[model samples]
Target chain A: MEEGDRLHLGSATLRSRLIHGTGKFPSAELLAQAIAASEAEMITLAVRRLHLDGDRRSELEGLDLSRYHLLPNTAGARSAEEAIRLAHLARAAGLSDFIKVEVVGHEATLLPDPLATFEATSRLVAEGYTVLPYTSDDVALALRLAEAGAAAVMPGAAPIGSTLGVLNPHNIRLIIQECPVPVIVDAGLGSPSDALRVMEWGAAGVLVNTGIARAKDPVGMARAFAAAVEVGRLAHRAGLAGESGEARHGYGASSPTAGLPVG
Target chain B: MTVGDLEVEAALGPEQLRTRLRASRLYVVTDDLTPLEKLPDLVQAAVAGGADLVQLRRKREPWAELVELARSLQEICRRGGGIFLVNDHVDLALAAQADGVHLGQGDVAVQEARERLGDRPLIGLSTHTPDQALKAQLLPLDYIAAGPVRATPTKPDSVEVGFQQVTAAALVSRVPVVAIGGLDEGASAIEAGADLVAVVRAVCAAPDPRLAASKLRQEAAAATPWRWIRLNGEPRKSPPGETVLELLARLGVEPAGVAVEVDGRIVPRERLAAELVSEGSALEVVHFVGGG
Candidate 1:
């Protein structure tokens, strides 16, 4: 984790390679603990039902935003129009100009609506919104979002909140190869190994919620994720061992097994 | 649901929507209290503060203008994980792709609206007297609002239905009861059997609409239990309409060598996507742990 070589999204350069979601917590106090343990510099908050009177902080309030870049997400929008509107509202509410454009069209699978997401990205980018869209792991789609001026392109490893762990690594790799913007693998990641696997493939970062929040021990899970994300980045930088189809662990020629076995 | 080249996905189906409605408590219907331009911001704030279901009821705005506002408001609600409803216009609600529509006494009949809106969009009827409320119970309404519970300035001309009426509506209605009218100042509506309390100026006209809504909802009982199910023996809150395939996919379970038993019956690998889990459905997934 080179702090200087940070995860860049528009004007914000985040020190943390992993972004955490503020949802599904048993209590606001617990959520706070998980967030602190996660050590995530960027946190994703969905614009959902508010707790009026500000009596209950809804887990978002009281957080030290100075340490975190707020990435408000359009989680419920089923159309590009809906997504764009949510982005603007998020901006007006003083969350941030940076928005994670999520246009979910399928209820059953909760898959990203690729067409809606692309359209929203283009419009929001044109409107000067630092749009980071959550999209399907399609190379062409990633390029399109990048072309549309998205600050970063988020290709989900699996459906949001599913923690499926990189169902399509090939497409994700293709996105990394072609996408001009930084590729953040968002959603469907379940474990530290899953995070490491994507970082190994050169992903800019991973945004996770369910993998941490739903755990029996959320704070511990967050800490584990934080460590995993840090190591994953280091592993990517260090380079992995070379690969081959043949399985040979022992010294073959040194033992003279090839020519002197019969004697 | 295609608009130009873009595909607008349909709203939640009826069966899957039950879980959300059961959990939703506060319903905010936007009125003309705020300037037309500021309505969007107010709705956003109200939702941000905690209004569960937001209804767009722009009285004098043109259909086209209302359509645009509805789109924005609907998106805001959706982002907040709240339901968005359009008041008095089934066509507009359908056009804006809102969660559902709210019909009044003289507006389109509940049956007619249902026929056009089809099976998915929520249909809520606003009633005042006991007969209308009782009649509404006979229809296939997703939910019904019995209101003017204390009579407020928002709807000056409407008659008031005391808390007793709300209690009556709740008694006969099979669906959820939304106590509308002057509910901003009180919590007795919830005590009187109202699952949700709909408001206008109480939330929309507050100095900080978001904070006002939070305060208004302070004493309400918690919404109904979430549809929780066990996955691999651990409790998981299941969203409605979530198929076994999606659930398995989220749990990082590969279809190969993974056995899924939903409530004691094994759903073969081929039938995972077809099987939908309801509230309390027990899912036991046995996927061998390995690294290759």
Candidate 2:
């Protein structure tokens, strides 16, 4: 498919293969420019403080926006309740429909709390949010998340910020098999090859931040990611020949169709 | 040339912008006029009419001329209780210490401005299409100028993006949207759901800028027809385990007029009785603030 092809959620389909985040950029201006250059369709943001119109010192200060769909994430929230509350605030501030539900139990590892992750996903789904839960590569937990009405499941290949590549490939592969919704591998992807590896294992997409953010050049990194995702997905569609002990067929006009129709 | 705070503009952050947004309607200053000897008078008039934010827009002028003009206007706008913004001049904006800078599509990118300016001042971008608006969401823009409600005299080269595009832009934009372009009659912009109505001759060359601004404010106020009401009954604080109707009963308000929106979706009336609620779930029981 082309870059503008729709990515289907439960009922909603998004255009654009790339999803960019709003943190860690030196400035908002660069963030906007990078997004434009990357041709991204979706962008994620976090709310640090309540922003009422006319306030001059808020975190949202100086960013001029009269258009664009904002997807607010529960980035720092530890519990399901906090994540839910954050989602509400995001709605009040004008980002209502879409939310990324993230629950971190251990702040040190920043690994998702599987139990709390499922709880939050379940509640958010019941409340009618298109919940995309981020968690460890636990097949059972992945199944539970989907059962909870999650639109998609995001299983990390490695700890966030680790950039160790896919550590739990077998588990991730298992989760992919068990999931009904799209299985997106998020966090711990160190490079474009890692992202491609996860997609090779049947992950529908990947949500990358630190990998791109920490790169020497962020804009160039974003372009690389876009290409990597495209090539990986295309490779999957093209299908690679599997290795086997069976003898290989000789290359020649062995088939009668090649020499054809002498009659 | 416009006189506003470069440090305060630098210090002027997103929190400040949000507060200002909630507190007042954003004002799109006329870009056609130059160093108004009576800038304070012009801004004072706008304040009297409830315009809180002012954008100083001047196109295609020499860099030095733009700076000189921006410096003067910024000071007057600041004294007049408004935030001043320079149009499409990041370098000049930083030099003049203007509260913020607004960039056209062809101007510097948002990230470049952020790098140069840091988190100190507000940044604005001009968008004419939905694609541009979507891209704008990824940047840290405080708000968007949804333009040219009509064919504007200030920018004859730009195409007019009628009110329909304006409303659509407002609904999809991640940040607040201000309608610009030929909004001589402020009511039209407000009716089209513009958070701000930007004009040129209407306020710049008016015989009485204050009156012109006040008239625009009045029209905007009149046009903002959102229905608001205080529920006669108190809303129940959602408990860890409670259904929508149970919560309504606890609050003693009939669940008839009040509709429940959990998370972001509206819960069906039939499901309200059995739908168990949880902490952090947002349950808004909305009733009509006005109806015959």
- Tens digit of lDDT per residue, candidate 1, span A56-166? 234544465557787878877999988876676555444368889998879988888999999999999988999999988888989989999999999989887788899
TM-score of every model? 0.47, 0.46
True contacts kept of each: 0.00, 0.00
Per residue, candidate 2 scores C-alpha lDDT tens digits across A105-142 of 88899888887788878887888887778888889988
TM-score: model 2 vs. ground truth = 0.46
Error of 1 at B252 (Å): 44
TM-score of chain A of 1: 0.89
Clash totals, every prediction: 11, 63
Candidate 2: chain B TM-score equals: 0.71
All predictions: root-mean-square deviation over Cα?
22.2, 18.5
